[model samples]
Target: MDLGFSQATAVIVGGGRGMGFATARCLAEDGARVALMGRSPDVLEQAAAALVEFGSPDAVGVVVDTADVGQVEAAFAEVGERWNDGLNVLINTVGPDAVGGFEDLTDEQWLAAVDGGVMGMVRCVRAALPLLRRAEWARIVNFSAHSTQRQSEILPAYTAAKAMVNSVSKNLSLSLAKDEILVNVVSPGSIASEALVGWADSVGVDGSDPYRLMEAIDEHFGHPAHLPRAGLPEEIAPVAAFLASRRNSYMTGANVNVDGGSVFT
Candidate 1:
């Protein structure tokens, strides 16, 4: 697909690995100048190198911990400075995956989950608003999970945090619509990102065989969607790229599901 992000500036939080990296590559391939922000300098460097290899010479890696508001502000400032034209896309993929039931989580753990997942996104978006406003048109794609729709006992805190994200995205969509800034959410299901594959490997699944690993994951986690297998990071990228591009003019405030057929909404 022709994403049409050429000469556009994109800021992807948590872009060093997994689905974030995949989205970065997709945008970069479409000629967007991308800034990848993460906590790991090594991983960010590698991701930036890969983008450069894939034809985004202006791709940069910015070290920023999204959980920290100051860092988020600084990161966006740097992005604005680098891309003087404006910020066309802001894709926030930062969030803590909180496992364990309600009783299992302590006050600290619950606070951490809210801090990392909800407030982190809040801070980043608040900081990026100025840059986004400068563009002719801007797209804000916040990450959510399909688990938020179906609900999960094991991921109570995580689910709550993502649910908050969905709510905020919808509110922001309405608030920013007049500015021509489209805000939407992408809720993914069981995607076989690198992190998921590593977990499968640790659990003795045949990670080498995609089909086998996905089958095992389905048996355990259950991805009863249209496709029999788990989705890939690459599979989620096109949807994200589309939502983050100029082509998506009328999709604000929508939570587009990229989880196979897991959640119909």
Candidate 2:
């Protein structure tokens, strides 16, 4: 399927590893020029190099901590300088996953999660709006969690923050519809990522194999999703790529769930 992404300029926040990196590769493979922005220069460079192997050698990396507005603005400026004038796709994936029960969380923890997850997306979307509006067609894909609707017991801060993301996406979709810039959220079930592994380790279940813990959690949680197994980063990437492409013309203000039917709305 041609996604109509060739020659498109994309900016992927937190594109160093896990789902962000996977999405970067997917966009690059579809012939988009991607600028990978993350906190770690080393990791971002490595991801960029790998993308070059699969897509455009011109794929670039920028070190930017999304938590800091100054850094994010500077990174977007760098992207503009490197890739023509503006971006066609802006995918905000820079936040950390929150764990722990409500009582277990500290004030600092809750604030950090809100700042990183909610405020970070706000800053990215605000900064990228000018560039996105420059394109005839643009997209902003915000990463959210299925746990928000599922009412997962733990991760109160994360869940609340993600819910805000969904709200923000819907609001922005309506505001940006006139500009032809589609904004939407993608909520995924437990995808195999480093964040999930870290959450498992923090729960005192230590082992070299994290998938076991993932499976155990899914089983205990009733595995409501139709798919038997957890999703892969690759599996989630294509949906994001399609959303960001000019091909997805009719989807806006919608929270598309790609959780193997885990979220049947």
Candidate 3:
């Protein structure tokens, strides 16, 4: 169960909060050197500080909007400067959800969903390529959604974008196989993130009570899993952490679903 992350260096995109922060924390606690990259400087700092307290004192937070090419390049440049040799892991976990249906969704909304879901991961992988190539071992874990596999009419654009992410990630796994870099996608179900918690609160549901909030999710979004409750961000993080770890040697081009039996493969 060591997972071989003791000396690993990781860059977690959107590592400021929720599942991103949870994964970063797992790695940090396991003795990995972690760098958190996110849009908000404050959130990144707080997350990094928390990871530092978790025993990754060298943990740093770099601010960058994944949507901006220049910002991503700059942020990775800083990462390269800080950890000159290479990068052991790259985790992208910032895909946004677009709630409108096909006919009701605007062009701008579709564009944003694609940008956030697919292009963001593409940009980070581009920026991290050189560093990954230099590493003795490398792994890439990209977060997608279960909606792509199960099909959801409510989030067509979001699901489409995630589908693209899954396809592109599989291609990347094959492309990077020559370098022995394992690349995989993690498709999670209705995770109780801050936004979901806020939605539950808006509907007068207690987000802290997992069963109640999950019932609310089933009633409102119709996204209930077979486990009878929503999954926690912490629950989803460990799966991604394993994929990003050196222990995951043969798993590539696979979409690991950490959903609570939402989609049967």
The global C-alpha lDDT for each of the candidates, from Candidate 1 onward, is: 0.88, 0.82, 0.92
**Model 3 residue-pair collision total:** 0
Can you tell me which runs of candidate 3 are displaced by over 4 Å? none
Query: Which window of 10 residues has the lowest lDDT sum in candidate 3?
Result: 146-155
Best by lDDT: 3
Candidates 1 and 3, the one with greater TM-score: 3
Error of 1 at 245 (Å): 0.3
lDDT of 2 by residue, 1-265 (tens): 8898888899898888988989999888888888888878889888999988978558889887788899988988887777665789999876656777899999888988889899999998998888888776799999998888887667688889988889998999999999989998888887767866666567665423645655656754444566655677888898888888889999988888888777678
Higher-lDDT candidate of 1 and 3: 3
TM-score of each: 0.95, 0.92, 0.98
Instruction: Give the alpha carbon lDDT tens digit for every residue of 60-79 in model 1.
Output: 99999888788889989998
Of the candidates numbered 2 and 3, which has the greater lDDT value? 3
| Candidates in descending TM-score order | 3, 1, 2
